[model samples]
Each structure stands twice: as structure tokens, then as C-alpha cells.
Target: MAPSLDISDWWVKETQKGTPVIVTTKNHNYSVVEINSPNTAFQQVDKDRGKKAKRLDLFACEEEKILNDVEPILLSTKRTLHNSSYNDGDRLLDEDQSWVLNNVFQHHPNKATKMGEKIDYVTVGKHDKYQGTRCFFVISTNSFRADFSYLKCLKNYVKEKYPDGVKAFNQKYFQKRRLKGMNQQQTGMNQQQTQ
Candidate 1:
């Protein structure tokens, strides 16, 4: 028999070249979005391997801006890469309702797994969950604000994030101005909803 390939094995190696996904275990009736930050990447790494690995998108997309007198490339490591407010960081990504829940899931929360999540607004990538455990995917735009980290940072994001082409993505996924943009279905809704 042919060797079975892990779904994630087919996913792109870097989030920059694809849709840039952030995967987490499926939300429970009482999921805790931790806000007490480690204040540093190392500290964060020590807190939770999965969360830290998931944070690759945060640093790549959220912090991909020039802020606090530091380059977006994260050369200085002097910026407020993490927000103390859980609502601002993870909450913003998960709770905002802007992302699309997908089936393409990625595991290895202990490692930085970067890759484009196909051309969908959001979904669980790689798997229905991680390593036999139930999981979900937060599929947000690879189009991050290019103000934080510029040089050496997100160099591959623009060219590859949208594997299917930006214009097509925008037309297919973007909502109308009437919706004021984004969503807020607190139940961890799955599937992409373009309005």
C-alpha cells in the first residue's frame, strides 16, 4: 500500500505563501482565552506550545507592522508583540467573526507551522482536529496591514498568501460595505459566510 500522507503534509510550509491560518483546539462550552501574557516570545513558548505555535500568524500578520520604534521584521524584539488584553489578541481573531471556520487544520502547536489555508476566508486546515483531538481553523486574510514589520518580515506574504489571486479572493469572500465588515458568532461557527 502507498504510504498514507498526513493532510498537513500537503499544506504549504509557510503561512506567508498561502492564506495564513491559525489553528486551535475546538472551543468548548467553557474555553478560556488566556490573557495573562508571558511578555516575551520565550515566555510565551513556555506557557503553551500549541498557543505559541498558533501565534505564528499573530507575529506574522498582526505584528507585521512598524511599531514602538522597531522594524516590522522583528529585528529589535523591542515591540509590544503581544497584547495583554485577550480580547485584543486572540479574541480579535476568533471572536471578531471575521474569520471563516474551515476543515483544513494544522497540528504541532509546539512548533511554528506557517502556510496558506488554500483560498478560503477561513476553515479547519490539515485535519478536523489535531492528533485525534477535535480542532478548528481560523482562516483570516493574508492581507495584513504592512506597517509593523516591513523589511525581512512577511517578505513572502504578499506574493504567496493568496495562492488563487487577490482580486478573485476579494470578490469571492469580501462582504459588502453594508455589513460594516466581519462577524461575531460566539458559538464558534464553522463554514465561510460571505455577505
Candidate 2:
């Protein structure tokens, strides 16, 4: 029998190209978004407000608290990189390294195991629970951010905590619009009944 290829290595090789790596596992399609270089990701962050920004798209989910508390420096680095105008800053990357290690192996069970010293965002995959489908990937720019540890620490303390994107949007925008729509419907009904 021909030797089976390892999927994780395949994913690493594919993602290094800086393009979305799309693959099918268990009949589900997944698109791994663009992975940026560590240096470039940092540069993008530094170019912006220098970590003073309140929130970043990277920690835009409900899981932000866990990530923010565990590795605040890493969280800030990721947040600043995400807040920058650079189009290549990928927010789809997973926050937990072990999650990627576990899922990738599950999908490619026959593949050989070769562990990397560290896990980054590129190897990370995000699942779509709403759709019940495959996973999307994000690249890790840890090396680049490592250069700015002091800055990350300063930002975390001085700057306000990153806001919860999902909660804020729902409370501020979605809820208001929904209420307006309901009120308009009620007004229309009242007018028709009186007429």
C-alpha cells in the first residue's frame, strides 16, 4: 500500500502560500482564510492606533473573556493586528491551540503525526455550528507579535478592555431596529382599526 500523506503538514504547506486553503472532510466543505506573516501582522497593528483601540475583530466572539484572561498580551497583539486596516489580518483563526490539534487529527485519522513545537492561528479551524458544517482556518502570527510583548502589556493595562462585539451589536443596533419595526406595525394596526 502507498504511504498515506499527513493532512496537517499538507495544511501547513497550503496555508503558507497566504491564500485560503479549502478542503473537504466528511463531505463538508471548509475555507481556510488568508494567513498573514508574523512581521506583517505586527506592522499592521503598529500602524493603527498603537493598541489604544477598544476592540478588535479577532476577539469579536463570546469566547473573548477566556482568551483575554488567559493570555492578555497575546490577546492584545491579536486585537491590534485585527483592528488595523490591513486586509490580510485574519480574524478567523482559533484562539485555542489544542482545538486545532484535536480536529485536524480527527478529520485525517489515517495521516501520520508530526507535532510542531507551537501552534498558531493558521492551523486553527473554526466550526460553523449554525450550519452544522466543516471548519474554516486562520493563520498564527505569534512570532511577529512576540517582538512587542512590553507594548502588549502596556496596552492591556492602559487601554480599556476590549468590548464584546456580538453583545454590543445586538444591544445597540439590532434591538433598536427590531423595536422600531414592532412599533411601526402596531401603529399601522391601530390606524386601520380606528378607520
Candidate 3:
């Protein structure tokens, strides 16, 4: 049996506040929050034996998964939900309890004759040093617009999804600096008037 990790030890303590820690699944890597549960087992394995299993609480961010698979391809981040105990059934190919997923090709359709040969959309995300934010950007091959416009769309998407988080960041960090500048200007004006 593989050693079970305590819930508290799952996260890196030193870097927890610095940046989001990424956990890699077999299909793709993503940001996840580890949630602990008392009744970890959701389903039963053996009907006759009445054996219960512990399930890990891995809440993955869907947006992060989308950002990683930017090319018009399908992505699967779902793995079997089991903790510590490794069973052959937990392997992704177990057809009895598992189903095959076609990922990207099933979702998007291209009418062109050489549709399979060309990519319609490209996925992209990066941390902007000037803006100090990270988000996903998609560029469409069919569209005549430039890539920068796509980035603007991506920024808006992130802001819409995380309005409160973005607002807090602006108020705490960016807006605070601007406020400081305004205060300095006022102080300078007062000193000039006094002189």
C-alpha cells in the first residue's frame, strides 16, 4: 500500500502564498484545492464484501484546464477519485467502469475539405508584467483580427469570471499605489501654498 499523505502536508507551505501550486494529472496539469473529507468513500467496490474506500478531494480549476489546451483540441483532466490505495480498476482504460473520450475533435467542427489538416483556434496564456495578471487568450485562424485583440478578450473573460478577486487585487495593490500618488500631489500643493 502506498503511504497516505496527511491533508495538511499536501500543500507546499513556503510557496503557498507566493504562487498557485499546480498539480499534474495523467491527462493534464492544473491548479487544484485539496479538500479533506470524513466520509471519503462515495461508492462501493465489492457488493458482497461491503468494503469502503477513501476518495481524495481534488477540486481542479476548469479555466486553468482550458488555458492549457489552447489549440482546438479536447482535454480531459478527470482521473479516478481514489486515495493512497492503488487498484487496477483505477487505471484509466478500465472499460467496465470507464468510457473513452474523444476530447477536442468531438466539440468543434470545420466544414473545409482539409479541416483536419488546419487548426482553427490557438490557446495562449501568460503573465503580463505591466498588468500583473494571468489569463487565457485564444486566437482564431478564421478571424482577421490581430492577436492583441484576442488578449484583450481574454483579459475581459478573466475579469468577468473573477470580478471580486480582480477588484480586491486592484484595490489592495494597484489602486493603493495610485492613491499614494494622489496624496503626494496634494501634499506638494499644500507645501507650495504655505511657502
* Most accurate candidate by lDDT: 2
Each candidate structure's count of clashing pairs: 32, 6, 3
Clashing pairs in 3: 70-123, 74-103, 74-104
Q: Model 2 — which ten-residue stretch has the worst lDDT?
A: 144-153
- Model 3 stretches astray by more than 4 angstroms: 1-164
lDDT minimum window of 10 residues, candidate 3: 50-59
Candidate 3 Cα deviation (angstroms), residue 112: 39
For model 1, how does the per-residue alpha-carbon lDDT over 1-195 read when each residue is reduced to its tens digit? 998544343343442265534556533212234323223212333445463344333332323221212223233221222323322223234432231111012211211223243323322222322122112233335632111111112222322444334333233222231132223221223332332
After superposing candidate 1 on the true structure, give the runs of residues whose Cα lies further than 4 Å from its correct spot. 1-70, 73-81, 87-89, 93-137, 140-153, 158-195
Q: lDDT per model, in order?
A: 0.28, 0.37, 0.33
Tell me the alpha-carbon RMSD of every candidate: 23.4, 26.0, 21.6
For model 3, residues 47-161, the per-residue Cα lDDT tens digits are 4422111101121244333333321221121121222233422323333122211232222222232133443443223223222222222233554211122222333333555
110-177: candidate 2 lDDT, tens digit per residue: 22222233324432122322112123233324442111122223233222344434344334323444
User: What's model 1's TM-score?
Assistant: 0.15
Clashes of 2: 6
